[model samples]
Every structure is written in C-alpha cells, then in structure tokens.
Target: MKFYCSIHEIKKTKTVLVGVPYDGTSTYRPGSRFAPQAIREASYGIESYSPYQDKDLRDIRFYDIGDIPLSYGDKELNLKLIEAFIIKLIMKGKKTLALGGEHLITYPLIKAYAKKYKEFAIVQLDAHSDLIDSYRGESLSHATVMRRCSEIVGFENLYQLGIRSMVEEDKLLPHRDVNMGLFDLSKAEEFLKRIGDKPIYLTVDLDVLDPSIFPGTGTPEPGGITYKEILSFLKLLRQKKIIGADVVELSPHYDPTGVSSVVAASIVREILLIMGN
Candidate 1:
C-alpha cells in the first residue's frame, strides 16, 4: 500500500516516496525489510494534517512509487540498483523521501545526492556511529554504510545527532566535521548554526528514539531522543535547504503497540512538509 495522502501522480509530482525493502545486512534483527509496508499501513491510523507545521499531507503533491525491487545476496548490486533509481528521480528534479529496509540504504541514496549537489551535507540521526571500516569481514554491511558515505561526501559534511551507543574504537576514530557521542538536544541550535544553509540530505534511523517509546528496530538504543524532541528538531530544520530525506529501520513486529510505525509516518509527514516548502 502507498503512504496515506501520497496520491499525486509520479510524472507530475515534485516530491516522491520510494521504499527500499532490502534488509540483507541487518546484524541484530532481521525484520526491517518489512518497514515500508508497515509504515504505509500505519499511516492510515494518523491524520493527513500536522498540528506542528499547520500543514496537511492532503495539500501536498507527492507520489508514492512503491518499493524498489531489490535482490537479497548481492549488496553491491542492490546499492547500484537503488542508486540508479534515485538518480532517475534526481534527474526529474524530484525531492525523494525514502523508507528504508536498513540504514545501509542511505549510502546509495547519498551517492545519488552527492553526484547532483556540490555542497551537500548529511544530517544523520542514529543510535550507532556506523563509522566502522567493515563488519563481519564484509565492507558493505549496514554498520559500515555511513563510513562509506563519509568517504563519498567527506566526513566534514556529516553532522551526526542522537548517537548514544558506539564501540570504544568508534569513539577514537576521528575525521573532519565528525560529531558523535551522547548528543544533548540543547546543542541542536549550535549544530544548525554551524552547518548553516547548505544543501542537506537527512537520514533518520528510527532506533535513535528510546526503545521504550520505539522498540521496533534492529538496534534498540536505551537513552535516546523523545518523539516530541524529534518534532522540535524537525521544526528547527525547516529553515535549512533539505534536498532529500529518509526514515529507516522500523521493524514493526518488535513493537506490538505499532507506535513505532506511527512515529515513523509522522516523522515522514514533518520532513515532507519541510521539503515541500
């Protein structure tokens, strides 16, 4: 099913929603591949209107192109295929909102964005640092995705927030423009001021939220941001030049309450509202 109110025709739409349901690299949990459909299904439970932005999804003209047909075994091929699809949307001047199978999907999306925007910056919200050189002898797992993206867009251009869990080695690994460790919500203003008005590509890993509030993820970090805090941050981001965005890693079955899916859909609504403007 398509996301609620994502009824605009593809060819005539400026904003697009595409799902990449390939979770072949998830280490802790495996059901994230089903996140796209889960979020779409959960979208029906919420309204099209956003009290925070005073905007309605019904008023927006975005096309939901369904999920990217991805294969299981080949990570490189899947990434190439996803990159090609995003490139097509970019060529059409479409601002995409991708629903992911896992955080690894961000690498390919950022690859496509990097080719199009010269001054692109990545605003990543995640629980893990995702800066490892490789994981389980494979260089392209979800754990290493951000490291790969950092190489493409430069680490200085990456702004990480809401990171509360990481290995000791990850803490020592340093590069330009790298900001990790436990993030205080109060510093968001300073971080935004530092990044200024650059073309931004936002990647939100739903595990960044506390597991108590959103436990439907492969990796559940304990101390994380609240749903209201995320909304406030999105409002702050409305002033930036956001070219594209994604919400990833919501394994719906883990949370029987289905609150995680609703939160994901609501975050998508907020991001779309900001992107629409």
Candidate 2:
C-alpha cells in the first residue's frame, strides 16, 4: 500500500517514499522487515492533514513507491539494492523518505546520498549510540549502522539525539559524534540552528521513543522521549534542509495494540511535510 495520502507518481514527485523491507541484520528481534507494510496499513487510520504544521498531504506531490523486494539471506546484495534504488531517485533530483527494514538500511541510504552531496549532515534519533565498530564479528549489522555511516559522512557531520542506552565499548569509542541525551534537548534548537541550511539525511529509530509510548521495536529502551517531544524536535528541523530521511526499526508484532504503527505513520506524515516544504 502507498502511504496514507501520497499524491504523485514516482517519476513526477519531489519526494519518494521507498521502503527497505529487509531485516537480515537485526540481532535482538527480527520483524522490522514487516514494518513498511504495517506502517502503510496503519496510515489509513490517521488523517492526511497535520494540525501541528497546518499542512495536508494533498498540498504536496510526494510519491510512495512501496517496499523494495530485498532478498532474505544476502545482506550485501540487499544493501547494494537499496543503494541502487536511492541512486536512481537522487539522479532524478528527488528527495527520499524511506521506511526501513532496520537501521542498517541507513548505511546504504547515506552512502548513496554522500555520492551526490558533499559536507551534508546526518541527524540520528535513537536510544542506543550505535557507535560500535562491529557487532557479533559483523561490521554491517544494524548495531553498527551509524559507525558505517560515520565512515562515509564523517563523525563531524553526525549528530545524535535521545541516546540513553549504550555498551561499555560504545562509551569508549573515540570517534563518537556529538550525542545529546534527554536533558540536552533544551539546547537542541541552538545546535540545529548552527547547522543552518546544510543538507541533512535524517534517520529515526523508533525505539528512541520510550517503551510506554512506542513499544514495537526490537530494543525498547526506557526513559526515552515522548511523541510530543519528538514533534518539537521535528519542528526545529523544519528550518533546516532535509535531503533524505528514514523511519526505521518498528517491529509491529511487538506491540499487538498497534499504537506503535500509528505513531510511526503519523511521524512519517509530519516528516513528509517537512521535506516537501
């Protein structure tokens, strides 16, 4: 299914919603591959308009290209496929709004964007630092996605927020980016303002939401930010230039109540408006 209220075809759109439906690298729980369809199915429950932004999806001409049919076993091939797809959109000068299979998908997405835009930034919202060099002897797992991304975009251009969970190794990582915890949010607007009009690839790991507000991810960290707080963060981001973005790591089955999917869909709607505007 397409996103709730997408209005344009792929070739004729400013923003394209491409779903990366491969969860091959998930270590904790393995259902995020189902997230794209789950979020799309749940989008119908919400309206196309956002009172917060006073904008409607009907005002924009973004396209939802549905999920990429990635292979199950070959993760290298899957990531390459994601890169190829994103390159096509970039070549067409279209910004991408990707629904991800897992955070690892961000690695490929950024790799593709890096080829087109130099000195662009990466803004990550997550519970974990994802700064590990590798997880389980594998460098390409979801746990090391940001590390891989930093290699492409550089740690100087990476900004992380809402990080409360991390391993001892994560803290010891010398190349960690400027990470902002819950308390640091008060200064977020200033930090984002310094970024100015730099092109940014925004990636949100839904687990950044507290388990109480969003419990459908593989790793649900406690003491996370609220949905309203996330909206505030997004609002600050509206002034910046967002070239591409992804909402990832929502394992719908984890929350049988389906509230998580609804939240994901709503965030997608808001992000789409931000990118379109």
lDDT of 2: 0.85
Give the distance in Å from residue 36's predicted Cα in candidate 2 to where it truly belongs: 0.4
Strongest candidate by lDDT? 2
The C-alpha stretches of model 2 lying farther than 4 A from their native spots are 1-8, 172-179, 182-184
RMSD of each: 1.9, 2.0
Could you tally the backbone clashes for each prediction?
Answer: 0, 0
lDDT of each: 0.85, 0.85
Model 1 C-alpha lDDT per residue in residues 179-254, reported as the tens digit of each score:
5526535667777887887788999999889889899999898888899998998999888988999999999999
TM-score of every candidate: 0.94, 0.94
Model 2: how far is 215 from its true place, Å? 0.8
